[model samples]
Target: MTWAVLLALAGAFCLALGSALQERDAIRAPGASVARIGFLWHLVRRPRWLAGSLAAAAGVCLHLAALSAAPLTIVQPLGVSGLLFAIVLSALFTRRRVRLGQLLAGLAVMAGLAGLVTLFPHSADSPVLPIPVALALTGCVTAVGAAGYLAAHWLPAGARAVLLAVLGGAALGTTSALARVVAARAAADPVSVLDWLTLLAVAVAVFGGLLQQNAYRTGHFAAAYATLLVVDPVVGAGIGVLVLGERVPTTPFDQVLAAGAALLAIAGTAVLARARNRNPEALRPASSPSTDLVHTTPGESS
Candidate 1:
């Protein structure tokens, strides 16, 4: 248990660092696709891109380690630290400024994320017929993500990033959920390790990476980070309760408070998303070329 905890923390640290580096690189090289080997090679030629990629790789490794040690519900929410890392580091490293509203949004994300994680039940159980259910859930999540990505045209770049972040969040969240399921089911058999969950994890990691890249491609740093940070946990929490059979707190007051926190997080994300979508009003045309040149102009010409 102690080892598992350590691994999960390591994963979180790596992911947060990777997230910050990814944000910085995205700002510096908007819309550069690293999927193409040639394009990836092109980026690697630059030290910054290479460093960012390395950080991201480290994050992936850490996350896997964390999964080995901790429950997905507990560990996945903690990964929301990426939002704070990206926001603060972006300001420091890239000199990108965050507005007061954005700061408030960040706080909202943290509050909600922390509350949700603390609220998770600490129980372990294995499920029957896990593979089919896991695959079905994955398919449904992927379909929704595809639809959202296709519908991004109606949104501005910032909103687009947020929406895409939601997809990434869902992907990772489901991965965590499935991971726990796999671990529980296979706890008794060594051979159980070789199951559908491993393939799902790989798919989740790959797609999650691409979605993150897409989020950064839109040139809105805060929105991209906040959306991913906020959505991932919310999705994970839902999976914790729904799929894992973990019972949420039953007290009326506690339930109310949790609901309110969820609302705050959702509201904050929506406000930020809308603000990002709303274009600034057109600037007043510059004063017509000065016509009052006056007699001084004629004398000067002479």
Candidate 2:
């Protein structure tokens, strides 16, 4: 269990670093369309972006190993640490001072995580759900995510970013669940690389990545990333309980504490988002003269 926790934390750090690096690259790209293949084609040429991809891949491997060793409940919340790591990394790389709100947000997230770890009841030995059940749940999650993606465009800009982020988080959570099952199965027997679940996981990762990049392009990074941090574990926890049959504390006090902790984490994310939006120059794209050009007479120009 200790090893699992350590791996999850390490994975979170890697993911945060990767995301920050990728965001830097993505912001400088010519186009921000989520469905545009050309966007990736442009980004792939950047060495920093490629390095970030490698880091993210490493994180995924670590995350998978952690999932196989421990229960989802334990691993998922720890993944929230990625946001903190990202904020710190951004500050260091940008040589900017961290805001009080950001610091408080980080503390809130950590406190919430600690509360969850202490109050929630998790069993490391829970049996994996049958393949059929997992498939059904995955299908349902995919359908909902698809619906969310389709509906996101109609929303206002900020809301749209958040909705897309939530959908991305859902995709990631579903992929994690599928990965956990595949890892458990592979432990007992050789699993095919071309298995449906494996392919599904790959598809989800791609979809989620596209959504995240779009969010970073179209909205404030803090808002989108915060939404992702909050939504991913929530979706993961639901799947963990319904599909994975993981047990939670049945006591009312413990349930309340867990709920409070979750809310705290979410509220903290909201704070961070607001703070980031207030001062977003670091993440904002450079303004083009054409966009800010004003017509004037020749004398005025002189």
Candidate 3:
């Protein structure tokens, strides 16, 4: 259990820092919109985005390992604590000072995570969904993603950020739920990791990440990142309950405690998100237009 907690925190750190790096580089990618495949084509070629991708990939591995060792509910909340790491990383990169509000909010997030880990006693449950159910879920995810992507274009900037982030977080959360099942199956049979469900999960994660990139492009990191963190766990928690037969604390005292912890975490997430937004350095792009196009990427001229 201790190892699982450590792994989850480490994964969260990598993910937060990697996302910051990737978003910083992405904003510099020669475009205002992330709708075109050409936008991402340029990002992959950049050295920093590639490094960030590697870090985020490592985060996924660590997160999966933590999921295999503990319940989805237990491990997911800790991911929220990544906001602190993001704050520090943003400060370091932008050369800005961290403010008092951000510090307090970060502590609140940590307290909630500590409470959640201490209260939750459920171990991981092996996921087993019927074939029809899996297909239906897959179809729903695809349809929603398609719809959301189109809808984002029609909406205003602020609304677009929220919509994309919510959809992206939900997709990633669904991936986490599927990963739990895949991880469990892997322990029983290594070859089973390549099954249909596993493939679907991988696909969904990629789709989610693409949406996330679009959200970051909106230049509203607070709305996008905070929404992503909050929605991801909520979606995963729902799936864990509906499909995996997971539940929250049944005892009255524990239930109260859990509710309080959730509130604290949510509040902290919002506060930290707003703080990042106000800080000049959160995800600022390159000052020079020429530097933005310095790299000879795909379909691009240096």
lDDT of each: 0.62, 0.68, 0.72
Cα lDDT tens digits, model 3, 125-214, are 576876577778767877898898776666655566678888998899889888878888899999988889888898888888788887
TM-score (C-alpha) between model 3 and the true structure: 0.76
Query: By the TM-score metric, which is better: model 1 or model 3?
Result: 3
- Runs in model 3 deviating more than 4 A are 1-9, 60-80, 109-121, 154-159, 272-302
How would you order the candidates by TM-score, starting with the best? 2, 3, 1
Tens digit of lDDT per residue, candidate 1, span 40-123? 333346676567777767876776777777777666566665666666665665554566776677777767766766665656
Q: Model 1 RMSD to the real structure?
A: 11.7
What is the TM-score of each predicted model, taking all chains together? 0.71, 0.77, 0.76
lDDT of 2 by residue, 173-212 (tens): 7777777667766776765435777777777767777677
Assess the local accuracy of residue 165 in candidate 2 as a C-alpha lDDT between 0 and 100: 81
Q: How far does residue 154 in candidate 2 sit from its true spot (Å)?
A: 4.4
lDDT for residue 89 in candidate 3, whole number 0-100: 79
Query: Where does candidate 1 clash, by residue pair?
Result: 4-69, 8-66, 11-62
Pitting candidate 2 against candidate 3, the one with the higher lDDT is: 3
